[model samples]
Target: MSSAYDMIPVLSCENIDKEYVTERTWNGKTKTIFKAVENISLYINEGETLGIVGESGSGKSTIGDILGNLKSQTRGKVFYRGQDVAEMDEESFRKYRKNVQFIFQDPKGSMNPYYSVLEIIGEPLKMLGITDDEEVIERKVLGIMDKVGLSKSVLNKRPDSLSGGQCQRVAIARALVVRPEIIICDEPVSALDVSVQAQILNLLKDLQEEMDIAYLFISHDIGVVNYISNRIVVMNKGHIVEMGRANVVFANPKDEYTRKLVECSFVN
Candidate 1:
């Protein structure tokens, strides 16, 4: 629609497709190809929480992986601040990796069981050679833990000792520790209970406002997406079936596939 580069979105996906090929032995003569994502495209405005919704196989997480540069795409373009991600070199890509971080669905799995909360959060900083003073690292870690509702006491505890919500909070603190410009949340709250989900969502809102960070939130729950997202992107079969404002898309879906997803999520 708009061709002006100045008006370009903070993150835009153009014609993304991802596939995996594996050898199959039906008659020792064929192989199987699984296309996880088909030519999908979408855009996210600056500081906006763009929600990608669909069923489990709809390529939502794959899209996040592609945007975060965690996985290479078979085809497509991902523009971060108007520059194509596919063309980035090691130095440039490392910088891009810092700008775009991810929060996985299971914080327990994402975190190290052997590392303490403080160590887990500080690992990235250490890897980046930021090497701050002990006091400075403690101060920053505690401050971020406070921001995410994690207690300083748990800083010494292992992830296995903490509750699910607390572990997820630690993961959030780790993501925020980097002060990333964009965060790709892959089902960040789906594992928590409804009350905990609300708490996490509130934390995200507060942090987003305070830090001016953009979010690419991926979830299958339309109600949750409706509550947190400014705009919604409906995806199916590796394609962007529809896109619009969250309220409008949920209320008036233009695609049958999108409508079916909404119906299933809200029907109960």
Candidate 2:
């Protein structure tokens, strides 16, 4: 019998690897390669949250970047709706970029400090050729801002002028403006306060429910991952140590690394 993992996912990667050249010998011919992610395979189902958890250097962010097409993997194929992303035509590639939006760990950093919330959120639509009309841009921006719980009054405020929580809400609004099929959230709530984190997480959940958007949620906090994910992927030293239903992995961890993570998260 086939399992949920057998189904073709909204976004999926097979045996992907990412390597970075960290050092070079005096001779240009000799160099040291660092493997940031190794032989990793994962998937995100339609309207589902697939949480990836690992420590700071465990390659979680690298995987996110690769999947979002912000960075390329050194090996393997990434599929969108079962089509190889690398082989896509120009029009198809454009569609992929438009449909796979990203939310970064530092909300304010990802945004242009000089631009107002309206401009920041509306820019993606124009960039993706969705629209260039000012009226349409403003209307869509305001609609998404309202959905993300941002007040209209802050529409003209820049990222520097907003509070951390408000900045994150704007970041989310920007991502949602495109009506993406998937959002790659790379430690999106890590920079906020604990209270703000909960609010942002809840907002993401509500938005996912309403928009039917999938998420590849990457973070170091196992607790946070558990709260938002239907399934979990745990990485260690550039490898996926374990992956399964969130509850099952959290309740009865099978791998040593996974057990350590669960214990650290739940032990008093």
**Worst 10-residue lDDT window, candidate 2:** 259-268
List where candidate 2 sits over 4 angstroms from the true fold.
1-7, 266-268
Q: Estimate every model's Cα lDDT from 0 to 1.
A: 0.87, 0.92
Across 58-166, the per-residue lDDT of candidate 2 in tens digits comes to 9999999999888999999999989899999999899999899999999988998889899999999999999999999999999999999999999999899999999
> After TM-score superposition, what is the CA distance of residue 89 in candidate 2 from its true location, in Å?
0.5
Clashing pairs in 2: none
lDDT of 1 at 168: 87
Q: How accurate is candidate 1 locally (lDDT)?
A: 0.87
Query: Candidate 2 has what TM-score?
Result: 0.96
